[model samples]
Target: MLQDNFGRRFYYLRLSITDVCNFRCNYCLPDGYECDHDRDFLSLAEIKRLAAGFASMGTEKIRITGGEPALRKDLPDIIQACKQTNGIKTVAITSNGFKLAEHLPTWVDSGLDALNVSIDSFDPRQFQAITGKDKLDEILSGIDNGLSSGFTNIKINTVLMREYNAHDINSFFNYVKDKPVSLRFIELMQTGDNKDFYQQQHVSGQHIKNQLLANGWLPTIRHKAAGPAEVYAHPDYQGTIGLIMPYAKDFCDTCNRLRVSSLGKLHLCLFADEGLSLKEQLQIDDPLPLQRRIMSLLNDKQATHFLNEGFTGATKHLSMLGG
Candidate 1:
């Protein structure tokens, strides 16, 4: 197992297949996605090697993320490669759900275990305003299609912001009350280019927690390989609620996940200042050299990120690093 200096053993990997997204979400890309320069993302063979190396080190859950992973026509192949890799127990994807309904079958056939669709607002008008996309209905429809097609339990990701969806928390609760979905309210995080926006729109996940508790939402136990979300359930509701409070006390205390940029660099934390390139070792099929480099990189993994101190590190865009 990959144990950092802080004694946190790693078990999850967030691997980015590409850095291109088609959304302009207010908190993330209000200006929409821009191409700073030409780039070459990882190939299928390279991704296979990377997953193998991590699995050899005891990583079990691999989440495929991107600016929008669906944009890649070969995403199913990517998912299949990771699923077929030894020691990988779960292969999931986080997408904008742009055209997920049209593409769900291929992914399921390739061994997709879970799906997370980003839907910030339940109202179509508000969703378009927040994400600059008029596809809320389509995305939700895609989710329904997946469920009807026998997909695993669905999870909807909503980024909580004072200006965007804070007032609509109850609306979210209503949406999930009748459905068997897990709705996660992620606290707005500060990034390199989003400092001013974060200041303007950040909402506390704790406040949401207070509301949930008052309403009788009971905290549930998290899976061993779960992401950093405090999940809750209620006897009166069919769905569950989760809060991802990054700025909360000891938020990173149970860090067991790591990220790999699309360009094949290892990120100890999403907000770390720089990434150590593993591209060189990725070219070879040997896991020894790759594992050694990863072991060396973990030595630099600190106890937690410096987000509270206003340091966004090398993360200007979560899409780029698959946060």
Candidate 2:
């Protein structure tokens, strides 16, 4: 396993299968954004080889992401290939869940370990306003289908902005309380298309916690030993609720993963401008240098993202970062 300066073990690698998406979510990928790198996107075979390379270097968990991973045609093939890799223990995916109703079961058969579905609001109109799409019913139905298909450890990711969805936090928790899925409330970060929306939407983990307390929640961590999300199980609630505060409180200190863009560039930090490209070397008739380059860049993982640096404007959308 790869260990950083602070001894945080690196094992997870988020692989973006494609940068193309279906929705124009305001905070994620907006409609007017002109930069598209579909031509530079990695082929299925290349992605498989990259996964094998990462697995060879002691990475065990690989989460297949995309602008909307479901938008990719042959996603199951990639999942199967990653799962077959000896060192990789988990193969997962993160999607908006718009197309999940159709392809989720196929993904399970393809060996997906878990899933994180992005659902901003339960209100149909509000969801449309947030996602720039009117598929709230489809998204919810997709979650139900996944659950019915025996996906027990599912998680719903909801970004709680100050005015946008803060009022709906308790509603979201209440709705998912009876389900066998974990609900994650992510604090809005100022990045990508969210840069403009950041000032108006910035809400802290403290704000979410305070709301839970007001709702008569004596919440405690669902697992004494959990990952970055400060997960809590309500006293009489069925499922757990989690808080991800990347902006208010950085978890970069214990960050143990890196992102490989669909175009084969490795980003050490989410906000970093530089990326190590492996596409060229992977195409050539050489493997040793490519592997060395990967490990060398991994060793140089940033201690923390400069979210506090007052970085403004949506320079790179979340899709560009393999969200």
Candidate 3:
């Protein structure tokens, strides 16, 4: 297995198929926010080539991400291409769930192992306010479609903000309590040029934990999967609620993930701005040299991020890098 300097085994790769998104979420991609690397976007063929080469080096789990991966025209084709690679055990996608229902069967047939949908609030108005759109009904319908899509696993990602959706925590839990889905609460991270927005609405993992305690939730240890969230299953409820406390509790000490942007730049940390390029190498007929370069980068991976006090750092957008 290819391991990083932290001794963390590098097995999971979150690949962004596209940087463009349909909706303008407030926390992640705010209004009038244009992505920096739009001009350098990679083609479908190049994405497949890099994925195939990465699998050969030891990547076992792959998740297709985007500003909205569903916005990509040939998403199913891209999913199929990723699965066609060797050494990849699990293949999933993170989507805004906009047009998921229309492509349900095709998504299933494309070898999709799991799906994580971004749903912030249960209230329609709040949803609109948060996502900067009024398509809550479409998203809800997509969830129903996703459940009926026969996916092996389904996860709901909710970014917890201080006064915005924090009070609705109980309601959010009540909404999905008996359902067969895992609800994940993500702490907002300060990334990109939106430092002011993040600071204004930042909520830590402890804040979420305290809220759960207020509602009589007893803390319990959870299984650490490849995903960043630290999950906790409700004892009485059928479904689980996870807390991705990236700002509160650091998971970088055991970080084992590597990400590739839609433009073919490899990101070592989720919060890191600069990334290593693989576009040129992927264009070559042989990908062995490209694979060796990836291996070398993995060997030089840092143990932790520099988030709180410059001690640990993760650089990349949560949306672009796959939450």
lDDT string, candidate 1, 1-323, tens digits: 89999899999999998889999988788898897856788999999999999999999999999989999999999999999999999999999999888888889999999999999999999999988989998998898888777784689999998977898788999988878889999989999888889999988888889999998889999887899999999987888999999999999999999999888989999999898899999999888999999999999998879789988889997888767
Return the number of clashes found in candidate 3. Answer: 12
TM-score (C-alpha, index-matched) for candidate 1:
0.98
lDDT of 2: 0.77
Tell me, by TM-score, which candidate is best: 1
What are the per-residue Cα lDDT tens digits for candidate 2 across 1-323?
56666677768888887777777777776673355545577887787778878777778889888877887788899899899988888888888887778888899899989888888889999888878889999888988877776788688888877777887666887776688788888877777556668888787878777777777766564321134587777667777778887765557765767788877988876677676788876775355676788867777766777787876323377777654
Instruction: Find the 10 residues in a row with the least total lDDT in model 3.
Output: 309-318
Clashes of 1: 0
Q: Which regions in candidate 2 have their CA more than 4 angstroms from the true location?
A: 210-227, 284-287, 312-315
Give the lowest summed-lDDT range of ten residues in model 2: 219-228
TM-score of each model, paired residue for residue: 0.98, 0.90, 0.90
Weakest lDDT window of 10 consecutive positions for candidate 1: 145-154
- Number of the predicted model whose lDDT against the real structure is largest: 1
